[model samples]
Target: MCRLFSLTSRDPVSPMLAINALNVMKEGHDGSGVGLCLRGLGGPFGEMKEAPILSGIFTEAGLKRLSQVSADIGLDPKYSMTFTPKTPPPPGTPKRGTYLARAFDIPDAWKGLAPEELAREYTRFRLMLRTTGEEQGDMQVFSFWPDTLMVKEVGDPMEVAAYLGLDNKDLVARQILAQGRQNTNYAINLYACHPFFIQGVCSMTNGENTAFIPIREYLASRGVDGYCGYQSDSEVFAHILHYTVNRLGLDLEYYKHVITPLTNEELDGHPDRENLVRLKQACRKLVIDGPNCVIGCLPDGSMFMCQDRKKLRPGVVGGKPGVFAFSSEICGLNAAIPDRDTSKDFQPMHLDTAIVRPDCQEVTICSQLQALPHLH
Candidate 1:
């Protein structure tokens, strides 16, 4: 089952534009979104989609297509797009992406635009839809968000993707499964908002994404378990993985989690107990300075919920705290962060990459998908 969740906070440093997104997971994400900040205005607002593969989210139609085409159909897992940015991004980073499409640019000098303006505009103009999970109370759905994120597979290098709404991709997983080694090796893909990329801008035809995958044989060997539900890319699967790694510390194998360096003065002066900004910086550092195929640990050891510094600046005043929820798409997570979905409470989440040693010759990342209470 897939769940939706997000965090909203208030701070003095950032504007109202949608900030960090959840790190992408192995199950992949469909619906997700972020708020726009233009200041001085508040109302439900939305933007026109530039791609048909990413448009027409009027109601259940688009969402339904997402489940069918992206998840069920098992669309071919492939990658062909490579971006040569007009300018180099931050530096050595993989958590960011090329600007595939412009989601409406804002002037860097807009002090009038508050964060709430973006939240209000999205709520007022956009139609809210979530992915309903069969999992009992509270874990009912993941808010739908249109996304076209692409990831580069270093292991095999396939362009992995996730989408919300109908797209006739029922054969997606099956297509992936078909390519598998006799179904014994199951392929797992993930999507969230934790990006450490160093190039590309937020422009039209430059939407960003992160992709990852692990084989089924490895998961089964570790006694890790998961169920592939319709349109369920492995949201629950991710949650389960989190439990194994963070709570169980299974990552000690070939992968190691190191607490980043922090200053006493900066740490002492900050008020947001979570210190999300520092956490994201560390995750980005993982991709930049760590090893090949780095693992960027998120705010919460388990889920990739809220946006992090790898993607954008820290967030608003008490928007939401905790590493319980993360979104594949900013809008999807934001839409569900404050609403009711059976029983799950929406919240922000953390992120991390499961860096495996090329010499290990095995897979070993344990985690799970989370729930939401969204509707913001």
Candidate 2:
């Protein structure tokens, strides 16, 4: 199993808090890798929310490739910033050639497109870069979204943070999702790390995803331009959220229903029984079957955590309005939000979904998908 930590705050905060939390629960994860994704960026990126930011690692050769591709595609970056560790990575740690966070100006031709269309374009561009980088095995692209940065490395969580200069750097954001991966089923591949992102949605998981094959096949069949990568079974969670909201135009709550729909016996008591029955019948392939706990963030800054119907995985959701935490263990939350009222912390059941939005007073628990609330 892996350890997942996330925070949604009204103010800018560093991910060190989350890393510290993960360290306390170190026993739960093997620390094969660490994945971090931040939205509602603060500090240098806070004011550049309107511009698209590209976050990744690039070699000297990779830099030239990026510039050539961007210019060739008419998506030149307006400004770029790179972060390297103040000190070298701990001995034996895997290091990146050059860590970067760049902001790009949307080309005039694409500026007129709708937000969803523009997002798809950016997704295509990111995938193109990934394809190019594969030939060299040096460049690794995490995310290319507006006001968001994603960085992942194969090493101990704390050591990886230091390698990225996470503590000494000016990296800050209103929301962050971090994971310490314990490689149980797969090789130590960087792309297989958690805290996966697609377009504006981000997600990280704490348990195995046994239903990955069917889920991957179902998603690939949809022909979504950005749904091809299956480096991690958990990546599908982020894509599922994107497909539910962007492709189906459904409310976020429906995401819960699609991924963990109620059994026919349970649905018999639902108020929206007819519609839900139709939904389950149509999208049953998307249902995930396994002992899993997932934490995710949406474009609107809403953060959430959910568990499989079996409830085999452990999780805790706590904190007050301005801040709430979703972590794999109580000690993780205590480390992340020591001052918050943890006495009211609750563990979600198979039937519940926990959500927290910026400035929200409390974590909203939705017991049934039909009653799920919307942040907007």
The stretch of ten residues in a row with the least summed lDDT in candidate 2 is 367-376
Candidate 1 lDDT by residue in tens digits, 269-369: 44432433443353332211211111222212111222222423221111233212223333434432444242432222223222112121222232112
lDDT agreement with native, every candidate: 0.23, 0.84
Please identify model 1 stretches exceeding 4 Å from their true place.
1-58, 61-215, 220-376
Indicate the TM-score of model 2: 0.95
Candidate 2, 162: how far from true, in Å? 1.7
Residue 50 in candidate 2, Cα distance off native in Å: 1.6
* Alpha-carbon deviation at 83 in model 2, angstroms: 2.1
